[model samples]
Target: MSNNSNTLLGVLAGTAVGATLGILFAPDKGINTRRKLVDEAVATKESLADSALDLRNTVAATVATNKETLDTKIENLVSDASYKADDVINQLEGKLKELKAKNKKLQKS
Candidate 1:
């Protein structure tokens, strides 16, 4: 299976094993055991939330880095295109001037 599927299955299996172990090992009365389980669940929820936030931050950083790299590439392409355009315009202007001068000489002859 895919990596994501494997990771999800692993998490589910780990959670089930952990919950079973916690319930089996408790020495308190039923009510206290239930309360303890609730507390553990809450703590696990918080830990998962923290992990989700960390993942979000990492994704944001990666996106920012990719955007900067794309912007740099676009800027370089624009600069190169502008330089090429200028060279073409200069060459065309020089050719036009030469043509005009040749025409004038031909007319005079």
Candidate 2:
């Protein structure tokens, strides 16, 4: 994702630079050259804005996906812990019953 964004930004920058250089080198009246520059600037600004929006959306989606995955893992871990707790409780109860039986036998004797 980082690589893709970098590539996209690089492409946009290259395009803007190429357009500006081309316009500057072209033979034309002063007024025409200035007008071309303004046009190029506006186009570049719009392109950059659009690229930024796209990058923002991509980042937001990735964050949402990661959050969901983290939530699922947490839930699964809690569920597993609950089951283990139940097993431990059952084992303790069994041990307590055995001790009680031994106590009763000693009292009877």
Candidate 3:
């Protein structure tokens, strides 16, 4: 179902095919052929382990990059909202001052 399983299955099938062919065609004794098969299996396993590790590292790096980008976007959004809020507050303060001045002038007159 998973990608890893599929890849492993493919690797195993190829190894089996190769081993069968080797046994059929080899001039060496049965014991030597078996030893070679075992060695090949071990090498394949090690290679798969290395590949899995590399995949994990790549996934981790991608996650970290995406998280950093999201954090930066959020920070920018907050900063923009704060700036707009301050602008609105400044405009309102100015209007209030003008209204108060007009009221004082009217009262004195």
Candidate 2 local lDDT, 20-77, one digit each (tens): 8998999999899999989999998999899899999999999999999999999999
**What tens digits encode model 3's per-residue C-alpha lDDT throughout 24-93?**
6989988988888788778777877876777778788989999999999999999999999999999999
TM-score winner: 2
- Score candidate 2 by lDDT: 0.95
Where model 3 places Cα greater than 4 Å from the true spot, the runs are 1-28, 101-109
List the candidate 2 regions with Cα displacement exceeding 4 Å.
none
lDDT of each: 0.80, 0.95, 0.84
- In order of appearance, the predictions have TM-scores of 0.76, 0.93, 0.66
**Clash pairs (backbone) in predicted model 2:** none
lDDT of 1 by residue, 37-91 (tens): 7877787777667656666787789899999999999999999999999999999
- Model 2 reaches what TM-score against the true structure? 0.93
- Ranking the candidates on TM-score from highest down gives 2, 1, 3
| Evaluation by TM-score, superior candidate among 1 and 3 | 1
